[model samples]
Target chain A: METTTLIGQLPEVTAAGVAIKAILILAIISAIAGFGTYLERKVLAFMQRRLGPTHVGPYGLLQIAADGIKLFTKEDIVPQHANSLIFKVAPVITAATAFIALAGVPVFPDFTIPEFVPVLGGTFVPSIASDVNVGILFVIGMMAAGLYGPLLAGMAQANKWGIIGAARTAIQFLSYEVVTGLSLLAPIMLVGSLSLIDFNEAQSGGFTSWFIWQQPVAFVLFLIAGFAETNRTPFDLLEHEAEVISGYATEYSGMRWGMFFIGEYANMITISILAAVVFLGGYNDFGFIAGWIMILLKVAFFFFLMLWVRAAWPHVRPDQLMWLCWKVLMPIAVINVVVTGIVMMV
Target chain B: MENFLASLFTFQGFAFYLFSFLTIILFWITVMSNNVLYAMTSLASGMVLISGFFFILGADFLGVVQLIVYVGAVMALYSFAMMFFDATREIKEKNTNGAVVFVLGGLSALMLVLMFAAPIHSESIQALYPMHEGVGNAQDVGIVLFTKYLVPFEVAALMLLVAMIAGIILAGKKMDKSLTEMMDEDAGEDEILTQKDEK
Candidate 1:
C-alpha cells in the first residue's frame, strides 16, 4: 500500500525536474572535478613512490578546497597583447561545454524520494539530466565543440607557444574525433540506440552480453580516441611542458586557469562514464550487488586507470599522435565497423 | 523565480523567447564584430542557438547533426583565423556596396514575407505526411534518407568526396615546399643559438 501510494504521488518529469537535475549535475560535477585533481595527484605520487599533498586535511583530503580558495583569491591577469574578451570567455566555454555534455550521460541509477519526505516527497529523479534520444551523438558533438576554448585561447594570447598549441589542438581534436566516432559506431550499430541508458540496458543481461566481447577492437580504439579527446597523457602533445609552456593556457591565470583544469577533469569523467556504459556492463549489478554501486566502481576504475597511465607513460609527439589517429586507429575502427555489419547480417 | 525556471526548463513559451533572443543577439554579434575570431565565435554560437531551436521543436537528430556538421566540421574557422589572418587586427568594413546590399536585403525581406505568409499551408502539408511507425528520430531520418532520398544523398556524398580530394591535393602540394623551408629555418635558428653561446 505504501509503495503504491508513493508511486502514484510521484511528481511527473516536468521542467522543474530538469532544473533540479541541472543544478545537481553542475554542483556534483564541479565538486568531482576538484576532487579528481587531488585523487590524480595522490595516485600519480603513489605510482612514483612519493607522498602527495599530505599537508592539507587528512590524506590531503581538503587540498582541493585549499586549491579552490587559492584559485578564487588569486589575481586575474590578462596579457597586454591578449584579446581580453575571448581570453576571458574561452575558459568559460571550455567549462560550460564540458558540463553540458554530461546532460545526456546517465551518472547514476534512477531513484525516487520517499513519500514520507516533506514538500518534495515522491519526486522521481532520472539517471540522466535530459535523456535526449540522441544522447551519444550529442555528447560527442558538445565535447568536440569544446575545441574552440583552446583554439581561441591560443590565438588570443599572441604567444608563439599559444599558436602552436592552438594548431595542435585543431589537428589532434579533428583527427581523433573521426576515430572516436567510427570506433563508437560499431557498438552503436549493435545496440541500435544512441541513448546511454539504452546502451546500459542492452548490456544488462550479463558480462557475456557486454559489447566489449563482441567489439573488442572498437572498445580499444574508443579508449585511445577518448584519451586523446580528453587531452590526457600519451596524446597530450597540445600542452607538453617541455615543448610549450602550458600551451594555450600560458596566458591565463587564477580562476580562468582553474576553469580549464576543471573542464579537462570533467571531460575525463565524461569519457570514463561513456566507456563504462558502452563497453563495460554499465550500472548492472554483479552476482550479489546493486547496480549503482557497480557503475560507481567501474567509473572509479577508469578514472584510476587514466591517472595510472599518466604516471607510467610519456606523451607522444604531435606528429606521432596524428599518425596514430589517422593511419592506425581510424582504419582499424573502420574495419571493425565493416566486420560488425557483416557478422550482424550473418 | 521558481515558476519562471519551471517554465524555462519545460521549454514552454519562455524557452522559445529565450532561444530567439539569443539567436538574434548572436546574429548581430556575428555580423557587427570587427574581430574575425570574435565574429567566428559569434557565428558558431548563433548556429548552436539555431540547433537549440531544432531540439525544442523535437527534431533531435537534426539538432545533433547541425551541431556535428555545422558547428563541429565547417566552423573550424578559428584555425584559418589563426593561420592566414591576424586575429587581433581590426576589420574595417569600408566596402559596403549600396546596390548589392539593397538588392540582397530586398530579396531576404521578400523571402521572409513569403515564409510567414505561407506558414499555414506549410503546416498543413507537414501534417499530411507523418513519419513511419516503430522507429525513433535517428532511425526515421536514416530510413528516409536511404530510401526516399537515396539518389540525392549519394550525390551529396560524391560532392563531399570531390571536395575532400581537392583539399588534400591543395594541402599536399604546399606541404613538400614548406617542409624544406621549415628545415632550413631550423638550421638557421640553431646556428644563431651557437653563435650567441660562443659570444
Candidate 2:
C-alpha cells in the first residue's frame, strides 16, 4: 500500500521538479542573455582591432553587472503622448514570450535529484520544462507570437519612426515566418516527428547522422530564415539606426529598453538552440565527450557564429531583405521540400 | 490552505475552468473594446485560449494548427485594423444599435448556457478513430486528415488560395492608378520635348 501511494505521488513530484527546472532555466538563460551583450561588444571590438570594456572587470566580465545596475538606477521615462500602459507592457511581452518558448527547449540532458534530499528527493526532471508532444510547433508558435512586442511597442510610442519600425517588424516577421516554417517542414518530414526530443534521437549516431547532411538545402534555408527571425545582422532592418533611427526601440529607455535587449538575445539563443538541435546533432555525444557537454559545445558554437556573422556582415536594405525572402530563399525552400518528399517516396 | 491549493491544481476540472474563463473573458474583451488594436489583440488572445482548450483535450496537432493559423497567419486582420484605422483613438459606438446588441448578446449567452448543459457524455457519441495506444496525436490527426478528411482538406486549401488571389488583386488595384499617372506624365513630357525640337 505504501509503495502504491509512493508511485501515485510520482507525477506530482515530477511536476514540482519541472517547475523548479523552469525557474532555474529562466534565471540562467536571462543571465546568459545579459552576458551575451558583453560578449557581442568584446567580439565586435576584437574583430575591428580594438579593446572593448576592459576597465569594468577582468576582460570586462563584470560589465554585465555594471550595465544591470545602470539600467536599474536609470530613470523610467514614459513619453507624454505615449499610450503608457501598452508601451510599458510591450517589453515584458517580448521578454516573457521568449522565456516561455524556452520551456519547450531541452537545454540539458534529463536528470533526477538524489533520494538523500528531503521532500522533493528522487524526483525526475525532464530536460524540457513541458515536453508537450508538439514541441517544435509550440516553440515556433510562441516565437512567432513574439512579433506583437515590437508591433505594439512601436505603435504605442506614437513616433513616426516607431510606426515605420513597427510596420517593418510586422512585414519582416510575417514574411520570414513562412520561410522558417517551410524550411523546417522538410526536416520535420524527414524526422516524421515534431518533437525536439525525437529530432535529437534521430541524429544520435554522430555528425554524419545530422540532418544538415541529408537536407543541406533545408539547413541553409533555415539558417538564413533564422537570421531574419532573430532580427540579426544583414537583416536587421527593423532597427537599422542609419535608416530608421533605432526602429521599434527608438523611444524605449531604461529597463524597458533592457527588456527588449534581453528579449532579442534570448531569441538569438533560441534560434541557435533550434539550429543545433534540429540541423546539427543535439545533446548527442561525440566520440569522447558526454551528451550534455556535446550539446553545450554545439550551442556555444552557434552563439559564437551569430556574433561572428554580426561582426563580419553589414545590414541589408529592407527591400533587399524582402526580395531575398520572397523571391529567392522561399522558392528554394519549397523546391527542397518537394525534392525531399519525392526522395522519401523512393 | 495547502490542500485546497493542491486540489485546485491537481483536479482535471481546474484546467477546463481556467481555460474556459480565459476564453470567455478574452472573447468579451475582443467584442467590447473600443480600440481596434485592443479588439484585435484580444481576439488573438481569445483564439489562443481556444487553442489551449484543444491542448488540454489532447488534440495537440489541432492546437498547434489553430495557433499557427488563427494567431499567426490571421494577423492580417490586425495589420488591416492598424492600417485602416487610427489605433490610438477610441471608436465611439453609436447608441442606435443598443437593442440589436442586447438581443444578440443575450441570444449568444443563452446558446452558450445550452451548450454547457448539453450531455457531452451521451452514450451515442463515438470517436471516429479509436485511440491507438502510444501513437502520437500528430500521427493520429495526420492519418485521419489525409485518409478520411482529404476532400475537406483540399477544399480548405482551395479556399485559402482563392483568398490569397483576392488579397493580391485588391492590393494591385491601388498600384495601377499610380503607375498610369506616372506613365501619362512621362508621355506629356515627351510631347513637350518633341514640340520644342520642331520649333
Candidate 3:
C-alpha cells in the first residue's frame, strides 16, 4: 500500500520538480547574460595585448555594474514618431524569449529538479514549465520568437533604413534556421529522444562516447548554422556596417539596445551549452566536480571563439549566406542525417 | 485506461492542452499574416505546438525533430527568404490564391473526417495501447532504416542528388547571363574607349 501510494504521487512530484528546475535554469541564464559583459571586458584585454577596461574595480570587474547603473538611471526616451507598443515591447521580448529557451536544458545531471517530488499523498513528476517533450521544438520557437524583437524594433523606428535592416535580418535568420534545424535533426535521430536530459545522458562516456565523433558532419553543419542563426562573423551580413550599417539593431538605444546585446549573448551561451550537451560531454569530466566545470569551460570557450571570429572575420554577402545554407549546410546536413541513421541502424 | 485517464488530469497533461491551444492560435496567425516574416513566426509557433503534442505522445525523437527541424530549419527558410526578398514588399508579393485555399480546406476537412472516424470503424480502437515497437532505441531505428527501409533511404539520397544537379544547372545558367554579362559589358566598353583614345 505504501509503495503504491508513493508510486501514485510520482507523476505529481516530477511535475513540481520540473517547475522548480525551470525557474532555476532561467535565473542562471539571466545571471550569465548579465555577467557575460564583465567576462568579455576582462578577456578582451588579454586577447588584444592591451588593457581593455581598468579603474572601474580590480580588473574592471565593476565596469559592467557601473555601466548597468548608468543605463538604468539614464533618461528613458522614445521617439515621438515611433510605434509606441512594439518599440517598447521588442527589447523585453528579445531578452525574455532568449532566457525562456534555456528552460529545456539540463545543467547538471540531477540539477533539473529531482525526477519526483514528495507530497502528502506520495510523489509526483510534474513537468518543468515548458518541457513540452518537444523541447527542441520549443527552443526553436523561442529562438525564432527572439527575432521578432529586431523585426518590431525596425518597424517601430519608422525609418527607411531601420525597416530595410529589419527586413534583411528577417531573411537572414530564416535562411539559417533551416540549416540549424536539419543539423539538429541528425542528433535527434542519434539519441532517439527529444528530451535534453536524454540527449545529455547519451553523451556520457568521455571523448569516444561523444556524438561529435559519431556525427562529425552534423557537428560542422550545426556550427555553421549556429553562426548564421546568431548573425555572427562570416554570416554577419545582416549588419555589414559598410552596407546595411548595423542591420536590425540600428537606432536602438539604452535598454532597447541592451536587449539585442542580451539576446545575442544569450543565444551564444545557449548554443555553447548545446554544443557541450549534444556533442561535447556536459557535466561528465570523469571526476567528481569536473562535469560541471568542463561544461562551463567548454561553453565559455566556444562563446569566446564566437567573439574571436566576430573580431577576426569580415562580413559575407547576403546571397552568399543564403547559398551557403541551401547549397552547403543543408545538403551536407541531409546527407549526414542519412548516413548517420544508416550507420547507427547497421 | 486508468493511467491514460490519470495523464489527462495531471499537470503535464494540462500543459499539453495549453500548448495545443497556443499552437493552434499561432498557426492561424502565421497562415493569415500577409507579411512573409510574420507568417514564418506564426508557422514556427504552430510547429512548436505540434512538437508539444508529440511530447504528449511519448515520441521523443519526433518531438525534437519537430523543434529542431521546424523551428531551426523551416522557420529559418521563411525568415531568410523574407530577408532576401525584403519583407517590406508584402503588398507587391500577394501571390496567394482563393481557389487553392478552398481546395486545400476541402482536402483537409476530408482528411480530418477520415482520421476522426478511423477508430470507429476498426478493431484498432479496442486495442488502443501504446505501440511500444522495437523502434524505441537508436540501434533499433538504425537496423530498420538500413535493412527493411534501405530502398527508401537510397531513394531519398538519389532525389537529393537530382535536386543538387538541377540547382547547379539553374544557378549557373542564371548567373552567367546576367550579373557576369553585365559586369563584362562595362569592362569591354572601358577597354574600347581606351583603345580608341590611344589610337
Sort the predicted structures by TM-score, highest score first: 1, 2, 3
Clashing pairs for model 2 are none
Over A1-346, each residue of candidate 3 has an lDDT whose tens digit, in order, gives 2211111234443655565656666676666777887777666666677787788888777888887887667667776766565567778867887878776554433432233544423333232345544566557657766776776677666566677667676677767777777888888887877656677678766678888888788788888888876777788765567787676666676777777778878888877877777887665665444565677788888988887876667778777787788778788888888888888889
User: How large a fraction of the reference contact set does each model reproduce?
Assistant: 0.53, 0.36, 0.24
User: Which candidate, 1 or 3, has the higher TM-score?
Assistant: 1
Best by DockQ: 1
Residue-wise C-alpha lDDT for candidate 2, range B1-199, written one tens digit per residue: 7854775686555887788888889778887888876777778778877888888778888898888888665466767776887766688877767889899889998998887676555577677797688898889988888999999999999999999899889877755455567778799789999999999
What is candidate 2's CA lDDT for residue A193?
A: 92
Model 2 accuracy (lDDT, Cα): 0.84
TM-score of predicted model 3?
Answer: 0.70
Ranking by DockQ: 1, 2, 3
Cα error of candidate 3 at position A67, Å: 3.2
Question: Model 1, B83-157: lDDT tens per residue?
Answer: 777786677778778999899989988998898799668746554235656577888888778988999999999
Report the CAPRI category for model 3. incorrect
Worst ten-residue run, lDDT, model 2 chain A? A1-10
